[model samples]
Target: MTEAEKFTEYTIPRKDTVYCVEFCGTETSSQLLAVGSNSKVSIYLCKFREEEEVEEFEYEQLHDLQNGCRVTALSWSPETSITCLPRNIRLAAGGSDHRIQIFHSDLRGNDSVMVLEGHTDFVNSLTFDPETGDRLASVGDDKWCRIWDKDGNQELTFPLSAQGMSVCWHREEPVKVMVAQKNGVIKIFSLSGQMQLMSFDTNQVPLMEADWCVGNKGLLIGAVAGSDWVMFDVSVSSRPVERRQIHVEGTRYFRWAKCHDSLVASVGRPGRQIKVFNAKSSQTPITLSQTVTYGLSWHQKLPALATGGDQKVHIYMFDSL
Candidate 1:
């Protein structure tokens, strides 16, 4: 289970260097979308069918840069009309312009559905509540974490010491959200404004990204300075949890796979590498050799993976033995 694996690789073939990526939900798996310095976003629909292990071909592009922002961070909405035909997926993206805008694929002009203005700095991360799509958590260089009611205008803000680089929401409880600080401190708080539950320090390593595993029982955190990853059992910590370092290569983004277990994915330097690990594994994790890797996301309904890095988006199949 530790052998390095390369599923599929393709240069997204973009006009500029890519910075971020996300997956839009489909009836079975999901679609891959990416953003770049060209100030444009590219959406590549995933084409998967029965007995398929990888993507067959790139489907039609949803929307080009003609309307969307540079798209620093993108998230797919889980809430949609069940009776609607060709279900329209909703998405939220934030970028260098410091704006959090929402859009629905069914809308004309790709108009901005909801424009959220609060962060004084660039919005770097966005995460939707898995339980209820009515709420979202965002982090930014403003050195704070903000939670906004997906259906209302009330946003709860929590200030931290360092610049906010990334954010994630707990799976079971929609109110708990995690914020990663550029200074290497990871803080967990409740959307109810209860209190900061746990905090972990990475010795100022400056974690550019982080995520909490489903059930909110475990957390996976990565840093830039130390080419390593850390796992924390938040429930075991009284005030602040001491992070357990899972030594690996330089990691850039941290994401918890949407699968049924504590599966996690990361893309980082030292080279264009993608690694997947089981939080419950007593042994170490297995790294996948990707020609270039940047973003990692899991499918909602299938054992499929969507990743980006080189020049294109790649789709892979994941199965546990």
Candidate 2:
């Protein structure tokens, strides 16, 4: 397998672990990188310049959220174009305090905003709809998947049999959402009917994360405990189309690349290895880093990747495989 070239790494000092990292905004608009750590979330604006030699990120601190609880999940609103008004560059973060804090910043970098309260347990995941950016889907240890409108009003709630770990919205269909649960079940819900459409069990292991492929409609990837991953095509069959045991220890996080359809990155705990795999092939993966990686976020517009773990974040740029 071809290895990715390391670009740069940032060592952010934190008292606790960085649980999540996300790229806020879009490539053409105001872009910021949000890092979620224990009890705090930090935002950094990555300035890019096009030199003859290369393009690099110059990080500048934008804002800090001292939530007094662990920041677990983060989501950025999609960029919109209304030339007369200022861009509503907003970020939503779920904390261990059982609250979802929404932070809004303008082009001038003002980040003071609002907070939404509803969940009773640790909020695990938060994602905004790509189409309208008006609706948000959030899941938590409370075993409830909630949908909120632009005003932060609870539009609907679906109760699950077990605690929810991650939630994501379909890129093309705004009304569809998939939630990964602690009981190894991935449930798909329709916002129009507020009802469950279907569910799949991935080895009956706790499914920690799930991501819908950006290029394929029915393709879904899930990371389970014991370092196992399963790819499911909901439109074709209930069974998994591909399954692989990447890590012998355990895997808590995995994400599909934003631009590449066949590229997927996974982090294995107790092993502290980051691997990039070509999903279309079962060959040996290219090991990006040996350091433990807790969270990963791919640049929305570029072919770059950022990973957070062990009090540091590493950025890498890979050649086309």
Candidate 3:
């Protein structure tokens, strides 16, 4: 590993085996939400400082999804977007039932806002357009990417040849959604009035996760099953501008830090390591953990990280820059 690939400091005892991790909150107070296969969700609240210990909170019983459906994906509403209110912010999750469920968080508690049903196969992933909170996208094993209004109305549907695992909105454009399929292809299409622009045959490996970086100038897509991750300069071309292949120790989960341009985290392999990388270089990844990690997430505002794998959820603060 090169100098930049060497992370400075890290927290100990990383998360155990987890199903998913999400970063929530506005630009100020941030929190990490993790979902476990054991039919529970864990919430960790803390300040971001690197390498320091952080206070943590865990919500193991997410009574919202009553049927015990696993949370396949998560998203937060834009603070300024009128699509959802502060207390009325919405979270969308898909699962084995082929349904998309929305949970509303309020001063009273978290409750099911609505359940979207239509897909004929397992619902795999969901993406909310931060630019236009009204629009949301979902992909599934049925090989179709569907767009829905926040109110649960169907907008559009695009068919692909591979299983759709993840989808994301372009930073500079709200109407455009980038759909990642298991066959290693990323399709970009508009979800505004009609299905405007569409592109296919984007990749050759199965894509497990797709995320937009800090300002949307770049996009990160990963296929942890194959230990391959790629970065794209949105303004340039459909081809990835950079790519990296890391040899993870075990079954991997690939994710980019929520609000950071240079940090990506994953839990898998030899010892459940949290590997961090600079997107600009795609060099040898730096291992950042001393324990097994199942899932990890970055805070939107603070420099801290929240991870959950074992029976305990941990919050770690980065001591300094």
- TM-score of the candidate numbered 2? 0.88
lDDT digits (tens) for residues 47-125 of candidate 3:
3333235444233232333436665555665542222344444567676668777666552464555778878998777
Off by over 4 Å in 3: 1-18, 32-37, 40-44, 48-67, 79-86, 196-203, 216-225, 248-251, 267-271, 282-284, 288-296, 314-321
- TM-score, per-candidate, Cα-based: 0.80, 0.88, 0.76
Give the Cα lDDT of each candidate.
Answer: 0.63, 0.75, 0.58
lDDT of 1: 0.63
Candidate order by decreasing TM-score:
2, 1, 3
How many residue pairs clash in model 1? 5
Give the distance in Å from residue 309's predicted Cα in candidate 1 to where it truly belongs.
2.8
1-321: candidate 2 lDDT, tens digit per residue: 325343334454555577789975354543467888887778776654431132555666756766667778898887532233674557788987899987775645555767788999989899989866788889999999999888989999999999998888867767789898988888899999989999887874767777887778646555555578788888777778888887777787788887778788888756677777888997787775555676878776655677777677666656555
Regarding lDDT, does 1 or 3 come out ahead? 1
TM-score of 1: 0.80
Stretches off by above 4 angstroms in model 2 are 1-17, 25-27, 47-56, 80-87, 107-110
